[model samples]
Target: MNGANMSARLKDKIICITGAASGIGRATALLMAREGALVVATDLQADTGAALAGEITQTGGRAIFLQHDVTDEDGWREVIAIIRARHGRLDVLVNNAGIGLSGPVVEMSLADWRRQTAVNLDGVFLGVKHGLPLLRQSGGGSVVNVSSIAGIKASANAAGYCATKAAVRQFTKAVALECAAAKDNVRVNSIHPGIVETAIWDSLIGTTQGARGTRLEALTAPSIPLGRTGTVEEIAAGILWLASDESRYVTGTELVIDGGRSIA
Candidate 1:
């Protein structure tokens, strides 16, 4: 390893993150790069994802951006194959791509529910199913699934979103146990972030504090025990620790970065 990499936490680690076009995914991609990982940042939004990859490289970090649709199985295959070809091994997989669909359960259409489920739950499933082998080939790795506070705590008008995230939470635990049982040395976990202002909110109707049409601050501040929304960088830091060797002994656990919203 180079002198700078010798002391880096994720030096030489081959890391892949989905939904890297914006929000938490973008923040994580940058953070992982800063820690010496070669980042594969994929997203459905090609332009933004490519920009993220470019930014990383221009700043002396290694990254590649691929246009990816998390709901497509073939996309997952192609992505994993590309990584295997380029790096020959996978060290970390961050299933951070998710969508937020709101409105009352009755008002939500079947199509909307399925779409939400496909992106939020199935995306994480496909990530684990496809990425696990390469991680195993690398001798061991970590999979960080980005769930939400909704997964831990329910709210009105977000039934579809909540259901999918909750599934991710339990699914993560089950997969973690499967890895442990097989003695593959792979660890799987989930992150539940509270009210952080991100692109997801652009489509998400604020359901907190009954302030449906209020500003983001008014909707989030009073409800959160910390009196503020969480930041994408804060969430990224937690993900970095889980991805690095620092959390070697942690698995099948949730690292909630929601600033006490889950408890409140």
Candidate 2:
């Protein structure tokens, strides 16, 4: 509803987010912390992740930074252990760690496919597998998987990325159904974002056409119906909604924040 009310929606919730070092993950971590959640931020970038946690703590928000490589099962085990030991419960998990491989399918290497899947798809699987018990113990929570517009529609020269994202979308739905059937109160869903002005976007398309311009103009803001690339804050807002009790009845759905690009 209003700012004060919306800001209080997630008060005191326990949220664990992957890829919290930069991009959408960073945004989500900060925003959720500001919303009064005890945020546990994790990513491969230890310094940056810890910096984000520091910023939150400086502002009097509860936060912890953990060095995490989402592809590592041992790392996931440690993450869960930390959550259990510290918060004693987990109310939300945002699976946001991902990488993009942009080559035509025929020209794509096995290594490229494996890398993308390992981080993008396998990471999501591990998050759900390990986070489920904590979420269940918490009497139910939400899981937000960050997919991509590529997951829904075919894109040129992005076969591996598309396939992994597509798998994430389906996996999210499947997990949602399972949780629903079990009456676990766990909500699992996916978010499909279009070209967002994040490091991930830059790394994926930085060398392509229009790469020399400012980040805003180069990445998007001109190619979509919305007339701009989605901002990390915008996407984080959607994530906050999904994590909060406001979305209590919502589950097993894909929320597309693509600026209507898919329609174009």
Candidate 3:
């Protein structure tokens, strides 16, 4: 469908996305804005987040940037309060901020494991904890927690990352059930994205540019059944579906946007 003719699926919805400075988070924010949602893009990279917000605004979309550290409880409180004060309600919350700490379990330090858990798992918990009330106030909403394909499958060196993502999957279901039983109209679901072309890989591979492409291709050739890595936009599309009313009946489920990798 043409951009102009496409339906504004999330029209007027107030959406908050964490870790939106770049990667899947940034892509999702842009897509959500295109669908007519007012996006609050948050991240630790203040400059990059502001640039993303500017890009959206220049494209005639509504968006604002907030410097946030999802691991901090006070940061979440401030973000939700701002949302409540400015928009008075929140229609969607995308827990998209995360980190990658890869190494053999025995070789990994406790500090490294905890840091990864804090960003990937604890952050999502806090987002749901603080964002739920605004969603409930909105009369109904959706929560899209970005898990990883590793959540469903084990990787030899990614034990910590996999564990945290698995926790997100279960956490999503529990919250989904809680909202359902309360009849609060809030739906919760997790999105499992496989290898996507994003900055996250920089940490995983220990490089940001140059030889990164060769390393990525070498890494994905056999692992991803699609014979290629997924794109941020591809994952964002799934996220948009979950966040919009199009997936109103979907809750407590995992939307796997991998390149057929998890099954393989």
Candidate 4:
């Protein structure tokens, strides 16, 4: 089918995405809107988040920006409440907000670890804890948590990042089983992206090989079997599938878009 026909896959769906100011979240929000879903984009960054909403509106897509910090339980509550009040139903929750602190575990401070945990793992937890209710109320939907290849494959200096992402992976399966047993019609799944070309990589760039100004391509060349990094658009496409009915039978699974790095 053509792009127009394909774009209607999520027609009239209600989608709320966290960490949507930039990176994968931004791409997912834009893609979902094009698919005819009403996008509620949330992030801690007020300015860029609003700009994202404006960009979507200019393109004739429905979207709204909300300032949200995923680690705040009360904030999650309010975001979902507002969605319930205005839209009356929510079809998908994309817990895409996260951060990575690339360093040796010994040198990492407790506060830094906690901060990473709060966003990478706790954020996803809160999204499901609150978003699942509205999802069930909508008669069933999907929750797409953005995990990473670090979740499954071990790396040298990314212990904390891996820990949180791994937690998200396992948490997804547990919730998926719970939802299935209760027949709530909600599917929970995790997306494990390897090395995506996003802002997140900027911090990770100099951590390895002691090269402070090493290019991403140079770092990825010897590692990623596909000879390149993934893109936010590619990652967003996987997330879109999970959010759409096309993945109705898929849950409690990890959609790895890592270009063979995980296997390598």
| Residue 147 displacement (Å), model 1 | 0.5
Candidate 3 regions off by >4 Å?
1-6
Ranking by lDDT: 3, 1, 4, 2
- State the lDDT of candidate 1 residue by residue for 158-239, as single tens digits: 9999999999999999999999999999999999998877768877854543353356778778988888888889999999
> For model 2, which pairs clash?
221-228, 221-229
Among these predicted structures, which one has the highest TM-score? Answer: 3
lDDT of 2 by residue, 79-142 (tens): 9999999889999999999987776689888887898899999999999999999999899999
What are the runs in model 4 whose C-alpha is more than 4 Å off? 1-6, 206-214
For candidate 2, what is the TM-score? Answer: 0.93
Residue-level lDDT tens digits of model 4 in 13-37: 9999999999999999999999999
Q: For each candidate in turn, give its C-alpha RMSD to the true structure in angstroms.
A: 3.4, 2.9, 1.6, 3.0
Lowest-scoring 10 consecutive residues by lDDT in candidate 3?
A: 1-10
Candidate 3 per-residue C-alpha lDDT over 8-40 given as tens digits, one digit per residue, 9 for 90 to 100: 999999999999999999999999999889999
* lDDT of model number 1: 0.91
TM-score of the candidate numbered 4? 0.94
